[model samples]
Target: MTGKTVVITGASSGIGRQAATELADRGARIAVVGRHRARAEAVAAEVGGVAFIADFDRLDDVRTLADDLLFACDRIDVLANNAGGLVPTRTLTVDGHERTFQSNHLAPFLLTQLLLPRLIESGARVISTASVANRWARLRLDDLNWAQRPWLGGWGAYGTSKLETILFTEELARRTAGTGVSAYSFHPGFVATSFGHGSPLMALIALMSGGRYGISVEAGAVPLIELASTLDPGFPSGTYFDTLTGNGRRHRLAGDADLAAALWQRSAELVGCVPAR
Candidate 1:
């Protein structure tokens, strides 16, 4: 992977940070992206790469980041849509969309869409960090933003966003079937990362587990690294993985084909982009 470029969002912390380090250690040119400029730069410095600062809450920022990344990197071999988090409160972004929905799903969707051409040209691979929370997702497709009920909590919203991640991966793989680029989403497992510290349930788990059950950030990043670097012919597309295993033990509604397609269409409409044929 020497000289190959890989762009990782949310690289300032958690699994994304570990993935960036591992990839860079393996000789891949890394583009570390984060909302905080200093933290992003720190991570990039550690990885011998460049830092990109972008606020995922703003679509314009995401667009500009994509353009800048393409301009800076001659070729992108991997794109990891890892910049996401759970918002404790139901807030609206500047785009008038739910914060969690926009940050965890829409922003990555837009970034991936805008960079698809460059990825195709470079024969790159796309990997997104989904979660086991997708199983708890009671997605109201008709009211995705909770604009009607408006009583949705943080955990539900986070789950819904992860469901969207899985769906987007499936549909993207279908759209780019014959193309060299392949997209896959996966659950990094229950790592003791700073992913859901704001939630009571997450806090409870952290308390109860006493840090035993929870895995390390390095372990959580293994599946993503494998998906990005592996040349295994048997690696399946439009599938969800858990810790590098292909077992369906943790499969959920996130892997539903029909829902994946619908989510793809909805995402395309949201981003104002046509799905690849």
Candidate 2:
């Protein structure tokens, strides 16, 4: 990782933080991105990397972040779309998208598209944080904001958003094929981290587990760290890793190429960007 440039969102805490620290230790130059200025700056300083702040809930912030990153890095070897969580209730962003869908899927989708040229030129790897809850998703691209569906305390929306993440990653791989820019999504497993803030069930699990639920934050981050490094074992691009391996259970809809393509187009339309063919 020596001399490589990696941009990690949500680097202020949890899996993103652990991954950033480990990558920096491996000699990669890190871009620590977070919603909190203090925490982001602290983590950046600790990891010997730069900090970029943006709230994914706002599209304007995402735009600014993209511009800042474009001006800051000459080459981006890795872009970690790891900033997001399950919202406990239905909420809309300033841009009029569902909170979870916007933060977890739309925001990263826009940022990645904006950075596409640089990423393609740098041959960067795009690694995203997803979850096994995607198996529970019954996504309707037309109802992405859940306006027509019952919110059901928002877990369903979160799952739908993750399903969107995996679809986006796969479609991204297909569009950018042979460009040397790989894309991947992974479930970090159930880890004890600050990521439980938005979901009640997750909060209960975290409290009960006392940081021993399934794995430590550091252990949960291994897949990301490993994939972002030059030492990566070379898993196929667009592979949705269950934890550390490419083989994992997924909803039948996840592999629907047409749906993935349609979702990509719809996402691009929603974010006001041209869809990649």
Candidate 3:
């Protein structure tokens, strides 16, 4: 991995941070991205790489980030779409979409589209940090903004966004077929992280997975590290891996070709992205 440039979002903390550190230790140059400049810069300095600050809640920030990365690196060997979380409350971004959905799905989707040309040129691996939470998701294409759904707090919104993420990976792989670039998504397991601090759901998670049963941040980063390093077996593009089992598995909706296609179209429409080619 020496001399390879890898772009990792959410690299300021948790699994993302751990993965960035490990990858840097292996001599891969890292681009640490975060919403806060101070934290991002700190991580970047530690890893001997560059820092990019971009808040996913704003589409403009995502655009600026893509431009900065394209300018900073001649080639990006790996692009890790690892920044995402469940908002404690149902909030909306400036773009008028639900906060969780925009941050977790739309922003990364748009950023990947904007960087597709370069990614293909470098034959980069696109790794999305999806989740096992997709099993509980109830996708509502018409109500993706969560405008009409019965509010069950923010879990539903987060889960649906994850489902969309897995589908996005599938469609991306299909679209980028024969381009030498690969797209993949994976569950990072229920790691002990500050992912949803101050939320009731997070409180429950801490209680359930704390101590002897909890998965460490480094443990949760294994699959990501493998995928980004391309160390795993010859897994097909668009495959989603279950980190819990350490093997490829079909997500609840990830197998439906029609659904994946529909999601790609809907997501591209939402993010104002026209897929390259």
Give, for candidate 1, the lowest lDDT window spanning 10 residues: 246-255
**Model 2 misplacement above 4 A:** 206-212, 230-232, 275-277
lDDT of 2 by residue, 1-277 (tens): 8899999999999999999999999999999999999999999999999999999999999999999999999999999999999788888999998899999999999999999999999999999999998999989977999999887778898888899999999999999999989999999998767664767787677678774677888889988888788445557789899887785788889878899999999899998878455
In model 1, what is the error at residue 124, expressed in angstroms?
Answer: 1.0
TM-score of each: 0.92, 0.95, 0.94
Please report, in order, the local distance difference test score of every candidate based on alpha carbons.
0.84, 0.90, 0.87
lDDT of 3 at 246: 40
Q: Poorest 10 consecutive residues of model 3 by lDDT?
A: 244-253
RMSD of 2: 1.6
What's the best-to-worst order under TM-score?
A: 2, 3, 1
Q: After superposition, how far is residue 168 of candidate 1 from its true place, in Å?
A: 0.5
RMSD of 1: 2.2
**Cα misplacement distance, residue 272 of candidate 2 (Å):** 0.5
Judged by lDDT relative to the true structure, which candidate is superior, 2 or 3? 2
Candidate 2, lDDT over the whole model: 0.90
